[model samples]
Target: MVVDIFIPCFIDQFYPETGFSMVKVLEKAGVTVRYNKNQTCCGQIAFNSGFWDHAKAMGEKFIRDFKDCSHVVAPSASCVGMVRNYYDEMFYNSALHNEYRTLKKNIYEITDFLVNILNVKDTGATFNHVVTWHSSCASLREYGLKDEPGILLRHVRGLKLVEMEDKETCCGFGGMFSVKNEPVSTAMAAHKVEMALKTGAEYIVSTDSSCLMHMQGYISKHNIPLKTIHIVDILASGWEL
Candidate 1:
């Protein structure tokens, strides 16, 4: 199937490799993926921070960018959740509401699209190391993406998926929450890192890069050996022992 890839701001600027890997995975799976250079922010930051007007404008731009595509997929669940669940509210009474609705239905998180639409579990990846999965709040509770990732991860040739304590707990990177409540955000991230380290996981994998970025900051500050990875990277690296 043909799909439009939505690379969030952070992923585009800081984690371009993940976007590249996502494209590789999709191409390998026999899907035609297109990247729209005009694509910009999903207006999630502003929307969540209570700036509906700014968010509406941003959402309008997003709709304009991908309105013609059959499906729009994002590497970050947080962004997917934003577009899928919040765009309508952000543009409810605006002229763009109809376009917003169309964009919302076509958007999908990478994992959700892979498992649900692609119908393929194993990406044929092989990373011979102990790893644990972190369920970001958006991907887990908001999008109800409980099994798609697991179904895919389990099939990696030599990867061992371990369960950590409080697997469903937020990594404490609630967008603006991290900036507004640094102390609380850091504390929760530290706790989440502690649990992942306790499992002796060589890597902490998740669907959201925001969580990984937050955890990585703490992991680096504290000199923790644990590594953070996006699910797309892992899937793309499939069975490469």
Candidate 2:
């Protein structure tokens, strides 16, 4: 199963390891991964900020970048969701509509591709840590990804997965939302961090690195002992502990 891996801008810039970890996990599952160096931002930031013209240009570029690929997968659900859900609105009533429709269907968030499409639950990896899962807003609401990550997490050799309060709540990293509404975003993230800490979780894991990165800021500033790790990294950890 050959698939093009779309590395979201955040992961590509700030957390490149997670992107590579995603590739590692996919290969472990017998997937041949292909990466297009020309791939750039999914334009989600622009779209969310009401910059439709900029977003439309980005949407078109994204489609063109991966048009020849049969399957497309991304680690960030937010990016995947943007391409799948918002591209239509970005390119509505345009000649690109037909191509956009076809592109969206071939694209999948990594966990969705692994669990639903591949029917894969375990990745033969291990992590001996007490952790709680944070379901990013886009993964839960946009992509309707709830249990797929948990199903895969449970298969880790020695991971003790704890359920945090309001696991499905947003981590408040709506890209520009955090910057434009700093107070509210920080408050939401602080509350989320508090909840995860209360669970005695050493790590807060999620399929979306964006959520992890947002919550990580609060965690780091307060000198909290907790860490944020992407699910792909966990699955590819492979007894590294």
Candidate 3:
């Protein structure tokens, strides 16, 4: 019932509220939450940018940061995917191999932990707005998280969930992929927003804030009529509404 939260760079710097919301949702489920101040990047950014050396350095630090924790949960599937899937390549034969393996088994995406680990179907939330889910590539493909998010959202009171055109499509915020290909990334975000609008959704929700940030940037820059929100934020909100 005890867990440690791993907040990635994106959420720590930009969407700290989402990180706090995740902790709130977990605590609401009657679980003990711990924040490791020593935690840092999961080396995903460096790994995706093709800097394995720099990534390995941070990966070591990340492993050491959460080495003592029983369970490590993150708000980001992208970062969890990094730790669960990619850490092996860097620590396979190294001294940190065993520790990284343990980290992989212990880490869970917030929603995944809620539905699977915590066996929680609802967090007593009441978001009375239209929402369409965006399946980040990491959330859907890498982490293979499909129903956990939907299962949790369906339980929120007065929340209307709609299906978008490309529910399984990428939001174009593939970490370094966005920076390396701005036009394509923007086009992808635009397409995603267009699809969400078609659903008449008041918010585009996803577990990954990176995608939200990308779409929100486009939504803001072009003055679009759409908004973006993280899944944890939705779950943490609406009780006071």
Best by lDDT: 3
lDDT of each residue in 1-241, candidate 3, tens digit only = 7999999999999999998899889899999999988788988988998999999999999999999889999999989998889998899989998988888899999999899888999999999899999999999889989799999999999999999999888888888888889999989988999999999989999999998999999999999888999999989987676
Clashing residue pairs found in predicted model 1: 124-238, 124-239, 125-238, 125-239, 126-238, 126-239
Runs with alpha carbons beyond 4 Å of true place in candidate 2: 239-241
lDDT for each residue of candidate 1 in 1-241, tens digit (9 for 90 to 100): 8989999988998999999999998888899989888889989999989998898888888889998988888998888888878876767877877877887888899988988888878777777778999999999877779789999889887789999999999889999999999999999999999999999999999999889999999999999999999989989884344
Model 2 per-residue lDDT at 226: 96
Candidate numbers sorted by lDDT from highest down: 3, 2, 1
List RMSD in Å for every model shown. 1.2, 1.2, 0.9
Q: Give the TM-score of candidate 2.
A: 0.97
The lDDT of model 3 is 0.91
Worst 10 residues of 3 by lDDT: 232-241
What is the per-residue lDDT of model 2 for residues 159-191, given as tens digits with 9 covering 90 to 100? 999999988888888889999999999999999
Question: In model 3, which regions exceed 4 Å deviation?
Answer: none
Clashes of 1: 6
